[model samples]
Target: MRQGIVRRVAEMALRIEPNRTAVLDWILHTPLPSLGMQTTFELACNGEGERVIALLNDLLLQPGDTVPRLPQSAPPALH
Candidate 1:
């Protein structure tokens, strides 16, 4: 179930970012505005992994633009 969630999020993000590595990086590195500027990792850390999946589902229902992306102001993903 955990892998399923990660894969689902990756697939959804692929629509906006084609590169798998970059998408995963964004997932772990980017802070979502809808979740109080918290990265998905942070959300999971707070024991809200399921909630993040639910939020992603809700966001998926809306237009593509509603989906979150890595902020330009954020530093590049570390090596």
Candidate 2:
């Protein structure tokens, strides 16, 4: 399910931003807790906390702009 969500979000990012490295970097790296999300990229980072922190160096992008998409497929598969 998570993988599906990620893929769908990637597709949307491709469509809307069309290969914007900063945006992708933000998506893959940003710590979402600042946006009041239940889960944070920090927690997701597990042992790689420093790397995740470094990835989130830029927080100028708003949370709304980085909302992830649901996969078009009915069932989400794990990557």
Candidate 3:
């Protein structure tokens, strides 16, 4: 069950580092302070799979201005 959650996290982290070994290593070793200083795998073993997923989802989120922009002042309409 722990491996399952860890693998799921690795799958998500793959977008950051395509290699399975490196990504797996990261998930197994990287300490996430936001997760109470637990590594992804450790947090998963503690039965917090959803939280780990959320962390990865946040990681996968692209940085950008996601807010919809208002249209500029319109030109005069034709008669």
Candidate 4:
């Protein structure tokens, strides 16, 4: 059950990453503890969780605004 929830969440994260509002809504509405990964999910969903969502939203932007580049380079090369 826990694994299933984590898998779903991970899949949702991948889909939501490109959409800021969706990500925000998801994190807000989803039951963190119910996902069966309470410790990890709660740690991520604490007070600063919203801020993290916002930050991710900002990072998804394409130019126009200036934000420091993520330390990592291009996403890992796909096979």
Highest-scoring model, TM-score: 3
Instruction: Name the runs in model 3 displaced over 4 angstroms.
Output: 1-3, 65-79
Better of 1 and 4 by TM-score: 1
Q: For model 3, state the Cα shift of residue 17 in Å.
A: 1.0
- Please, what is the whole-model Cα lDDT of each candidate in the order they appear? 0.67, 0.41, 0.67, 0.42
The sequence of per-residue lDDT tens digits that candidate 2 reaches over residues 1-79 is 2224444444444544466674466456543444433222333334333332332333323366674331121334679
Candidate achieving higher lDDT, 1 or 4: 1
Q: Candidate 1 residues 7-63, lDDT tens each?
A: 666676676568888877877888776678887767766666676677656655766
Worst 10 residues of 3 by lDDT: 66-75
After best superposition, candidate 4 residue 27: deviation in angstroms?
A: 12
- Higher-scoring candidate on TM-score, 2 or 4: 2
Model 1 residue pairs with clashes: none
- Where model 4 places Cα greater than 4 Å from the true spot, the runs are 1-45, 64-79
Question: What lDDT is reached at residue 9 by model 3?
Answer: 73
Q: Give per-candidate clash totals.
A: 0, 0, 0, 0
Relative to the unseen true structure, what is the C-alpha lDDT of residue 75 in candidate 2, on a scale of 0 to 100? 38
Selected candidate, larger TM-score, 3 vs 4 = 3
**RMSD after Cα superposition, model 2:** 14.3
Q: TM-scores of all models?
A: 0.56, 0.34, 0.68, 0.28
Candidate 2: list runs displaced more than 4 Å. Answer: 31-79
